[model samples]
Target: MEATKSADVVVVCAGLVEMAEVEGVDRDTLSLTPGHDELIKRVAAAHKKVAVVLSNGAPVSMPWLADVSAVLEGYLGGQAGAGGLADLLTGKVTPSGKLAETFPLSLEDTSAKPYPGGPLVVEYRESLYVGYRYYDTAKIDVLFPFGYGLSYTKFEYRDLSLKQTGDKVTVSFKVKNSGAVAGKEIAQVYVRDVESTWFRPEKELKGFAKVDLQPGEEKEVSVELGTRAFAYYDTGSKDWVVEAGEFEILVGASSQDIRLKASHKLAGQGIVSAADKAKLASYYNVTPTTEFTLSAFEALLGRPVPANIQPGKGQFTMNTPLSDMTDSFMGRQMNKVMQNEIAKMIKGREDTPTGLTMRTMAKEMPLRSIAMGGGSLNLSKLKAILLMINGHTFQGIKALLGKK
Candidate 1:
């Protein structure tokens, strides 16, 4: 706060370093670091010209968004990213990037909650309600919607039309730069089954096109959609089914920001034998099931879901991550040693993003992965550790000797 009070511009670089990031695991939360969030809020409060440049691999929440002047989501920029950011910030080029994933207001607003809950099993009970599919369908307010991006210029959508040639669709629209500067716009195309009274997403992103325009420049953009765009996979029959119905075509800047819409009746031979409407809970409903029930989910899974459980004493395996193994005595000892090792790896720069991530990975990483990731911890040593963790220390010692 003291540093930014006298500064003209405060640029806060924050967000996930590189997602739950690769083979490590899912992130526990969609939040910025406590220190980063505090700095952003305080800095933005002091200086209105706060430009937050987020360099992350996954979507993160921005609670202090309204307090800041500008935000640039620079997700996982590579070697030339610094030069690119300079060009964008210095007005050498116009920003034309769109968010591929929705940024929830908080972790609770997301479809996938209780994330990374257990070591053994995770239930994706939200079914098809994934990403924008869930947010758009549930009408949940988000910090940023999918396919959302802002430019130095404004854009207008006009002459929206859809041409249906048999089962395929070609959606056409005209985009004009309504603002003074030249800019690029992403026109996202979404398809909704207006006649579908089933467990379908309210709308699904089918296709999209990038439109570049000069001031007052207008260009026609078209997106092609095949049968797959209008069909859903039938689990029972193990095939895609496109039932004859009325479909709505939507073109917009994001899933929630629909600019132009048109409806078309798709002519089909009706539902095939593959579509078992009885099991779908669709034949009796007039709208997509918004509130998903456990029974319904279990019915969809074709089996009962096992109760979510956590790893504990006598259950520790080489596959258990250092983080999950805290329930056991030997596991806690192992975690302490690993933390000391990681502390040495980062040394003085323990607070940096790379350092924080390295430390985080060490905790989340499975005991067996040390061998798999080509470290000194081999399979024999891993077996010994597992045996000791499960309360067979003498046996573990014998096993280690046998391996040697």
Candidate 2:
């Protein structure tokens, strides 16, 4: 390895400082600096095989992506890294990392609108056209798209299938590692409306699955599309109106690489009537789901109930809160079940009380315990009240919590 400034993941890897210069600048409006071009050339010459790793907080014009033999993103891989990079580089670890942002061929294919902070207060002028949503909607070609990544080993994606089970839609496929080396593969699922009444993206990522495969081994990727996944945030309707229509499902390595695809019409029908859309729009600027925070609580309880459920005609109760039906026996039982599950999660947080005690015994705790005080107390409480029923102040608990 060369003597260079290390970033979170092999930081400042000979060329990062040059790349960082255009961080906040608009890719389309901006041009590459001469110094950056020189730095790129110099870095390419430093290594035996020039593999460009594109990592940034947001998208950048990768006119240079095709120029390099390979590109990997270490997007926001903070602090402790390099070991992972070294492993992937030396073939010790296969590059299983997938992209978190879309890389545009040029900034033009990107969202046409720029951030609103130009000589005025910053505002979101682009509205919904963010990330791949913008590029796909505008039909702009991207350099590299969201969910795009490559591995040393080659994988073949095949056998696309779609089926409707009640309101749920299932898209299943097979991915085989045809290359010599064992590796990991990500199966990407994208959905596009065939007869959308309003303007929509060409395709949107519905789901993704990651799997490990030995050389020549094949694995199945099954993605289920719920009502929510297919629905778009209708600004006018003020709801996620799943308008009745045919939709195309695309499965592939990246957005552009469509290995297999299929189309199906939605079962039953959900019509967002003009009256409903108008009434909803008057109450709020857009549909309720647009501003609602998706809750993990739905997944927390054994049953699926909205943590932060969205408001719509049939999606949820109109006047009654989903969690407020506890007066009824079924509702009370559900509440109890949710409470028990939440308790389990809280208790799980204190799993290593004995380890904290050991650290305290060694008196090696750092001084920033103030930041961690409550956590240590919770652990101690769990060990005493829940684990042993011996509610004594465990030594080193204070130190572990930054109290020392």
Candidate 3:
């Protein structure tokens, strides 16, 4: 401490240790392990100009952030990382990298708690509510949010617009460099379903564009949104379906730093199957057997079910297994209809089983089962099955297939 007080400037290189970052080793805490935090605090108190260079892969709680002059994140950089840091520090390279994950104020503020459940089995209780999605939706305060990065220059956002044609949404906004130096800004677009029937995250990242702007230079940025942007995975239908309702378009530099907003109404696609409609009701926190009626199902499906179909006696929950439902008169009819429709959908597929049975396959089938030798598969049907089994969106499957 005494030696640092004599220096003109203090540079503290602090971050997680090797044990905390390894794959199999689980970190016990989100703190800067042991005396690192205290050391940084002492250095900041001793020197007026103190810059902290973090050298960890994951986010750590920084209690001394406000006391430091600057903080640079160097996330496990490789051989040339030291040289890159020197260049950034000396103003030879403008830092434009952003945080891909959120940094919580403390360990308790994070979504993942009681982490690393067991050596053999690790249960992911957080599910989709990970990182910024959890913090943003739960309204939890964090030290830094996803896509947050500070540059030497400043940028301004203005004139946000949302244009929709059929199922596509186009988001456009103007960005200007308001500071003295040239730098790049990553503009992010997040969408929120205002009145969805199913539960959805408060906001989801739909699109993002990065642009380099010279000082006083202005540019118009546009990001396109497809069906997946405003849709949810409907487990019953085995498809991604968009609910008809209002959607909020948010444009911002970071998840917590939303600057502009607009709303759009989507004309939802009608449901085709009775199972999907029931699942949608379940998503709305309603028991399908009690809250759902035959009339309502017909309305959503855009066609009437067989007149003979009737829910005769006891209460039925959406969680009721398909086999159990088949004992009822209405259930039996609905089951046959669903089976016929499914058969028609996969009529010509090579992988279509000779005898379709309720029995589970003896072994896991490879993804290539849908494809024939040197021939194309039914991509639409394959996408539906993929979404059903793997819970992946069409865009996600496309990414796995290396398609643009």
Name the candidate that leads on lDDT: 1
The residue-by-residue lDDT of candidate 3 on 109-187, one tens digit each, is 7655545343223444344467887777677788989999999899999999988877788999999999998899999
Candidate numbers, best TM-score first, in rank order: 1, 3, 2
Which runs in model 2 stand beyond 4 Å of their true positions? Answer: 1-36, 43-48, 53-55, 62-67, 112-115, 118-123, 268-404
TM-score-better candidate, 2 vs 3:
3
Give the best candidate by TM-score: 1
lDDT by residue for model 2 (1-404), tens: 35422322222232333333332223233333335445555555554345655444565554444444565666556665666776776789888877777777765444543332422123343445578776665566677777788888999988899888987988999999999999998888989888765446678888988889999999888999998767866544466778787999999888777799898887434454555434333222322123211132122122344233333222222123324433344334434544454455446443343332332322222122222555443544322221111122343344344454
Candidate 3: regions farther than 4 A off? 114-116, 270-404
Clashing pairs in 2: 6-11, 7-11, 105-143, 238-286, 238-287, 239-287, 369-401, 369-402, 370-402
Position 254, candidate 1: lDDT: 89
RMSD of 3: 17.6
Residue-level error in angstroms, candidate 2, position 114? 4.4
Write the residue-wise lDDT of candidate 1 on 59-146 in tens digits: 8888888899999999878999988988898888999999899888888777655353355877776778888888877778888999
RMSD of each: 4.2, 16.4, 17.6
Model 1 clash tally, residue pairs: 0
TM-score of each: 0.82, 0.58, 0.66
In candidate 3, list every pair of residues with a backbone clash. Answer: none
lDDT per model, in order? 0.80, 0.57, 0.70
